[model samples]
Target: MGSDVDFVAYVCEQAGLGGALSYRKMFGEYALYLDERVVALVCDNMLFVKPTTAGRALLDTVEEAPPYPGAKPHWRMDDVLDDGERLGRLLVATAAALPRPKPKGPKVARPGAPRKR
Candidate 1:
């Protein structure tokens, strides 16, 4: 009986994925994010990641049920979830693609917009 924290830490440690990989509670489960981009998830001690060259490969090696049901197949990409190398590559790729957190600018009125009296 592994919890979200346990699984998340395990993934980061096991896969040796660098950068900040966080776990957020979503859809009543834990969503895995690499540099703030959702890349995978941990549910019921099962790992389900989005489709990627590495992620797909991970899914390809396993034949277990995916985290989310009503989905096409087991795992997100395929039915298997193995290969730490792929998982690491996937995490690195995802981390590299993460969008930088830009400072929010103040909203300004649109052109020709009426001024509030």
Candidate 2:
């Protein structure tokens, strides 16, 4: 089944990161990004945080699972739905550990364009 919009919103809201928090639809699921770094993924109404030492230390109980088929095991954080503070901290730490996203090159206009009268 496909993930619901409300679920995605709820996850982002709970993350509580002041830095640009955004999500994008991918393969009918959602990828949650904090400051351009992908922190978590919402698939089938479940939250999966990227596994990191800092993130793992913050969790009370660690549960490893894949966000989707053939994906690597991540830190499943289903219980964080109600804890915005914890969720926010987790996301922040996860984002900090992840490498910064590479800058996208500017798009160039096509040559031989029609001239305007």
Candidate 3:
């Protein structure tokens, strides 16, 4: 089943980060980003944060699970929905530990393409 849009919105609001936070639909799931770095995923109404040392240290307890089949284990943040402060802190720490996103090259025009008049 696909993830719920309302759930995704709720998760983002709970995080309460001041960075460039956003999400993209991928294969019926959602990929959550913080400051252009992917921090978590919302799949089937569950929040799966990347397992980082910083994030793990912030949480009181750690629970690892896969967001989808055949995926690596992630820190299953089931309690974050009701705790905005915890969610925010987790996201901030995870984003800080993650490497900056690589720059994407500009798209090239097709060879021998006609120029506009």
Candidate 4:
């Protein structure tokens, strides 16, 4: 089943990270980003945070699972959702550990479009 938008919004609101937190819907799921770095995935109403050294260290009970089929296991964060402070901390650490996203290439002109003189 697809994840509900309310669930995704609740998750972001619970993070309490303010403007830095955002989510994008993909297919039937959602990807949560912190400061432009992808920090977690919400699928089937389950939250899967990207595993990182700092993030793992903060977890009291470590759990791992894939957000979707054929994907690598992430740190399943069902236990941490209610704790906004811990969730914020983990997200910051994960975002810090992750490399910045690669720059997107410039758009190419479509064929048959009029060229500039």
Best by lDDT: 4
lDDT per prediction? 0.62, 0.88, 0.89, 0.92
> Model 4 over residues 1-117: C-alpha lDDT tens digits?
999999999998888988899999998899999978999999999999999998888888888888999999998889899999999899999999999999999989899999989
- lDDT of residue 85 for candidate 1: 69
User: How does model 4 fare in lDDT?
Assistant: 0.92
The count of residue-pair clashes in candidate 2 stands at 0
Superposed on all Cα atoms, model 4 deviates from the true structure by an RMSD in Å of 2.3
Can you tell me which runs of candidate 3 are displaced by over 4 Å? Answer: 108-117
What's the best-to-worst order under lDDT? 4, 3, 2, 1
Highest-TM-score candidate: 4
Q: Which segments of model 2 are wrong by more than 4 Å?
A: 106-117
Would you list the clashing residue pairs of candidate 3?
Answer: none
TM-score of each: 0.55, 0.85, 0.87, 0.90
The per-prediction CA RMSD against the true structure, in angstroms, equals 6.3, 3.1, 2.5, 2.3
lDDT agreement of model 1 with the native: 0.62
What's the distance in Å from true for residue 110, model 2? 13
lDDT of 2 by residue, 10-116 (tens): 88888776547899999999999987899999999999999988898788898899988999998888898799999999999999999998889996667987756
- Writing each residue's lDDT as its tens digit, candidate 3 over 1-117 gives 999999998898887865467899999999999878889999999999999999888888888999999999998889777999889988989999999988999977788998668
Q: Which is the winner by TM-score between candidate 1 and candidate 3?
A: 3
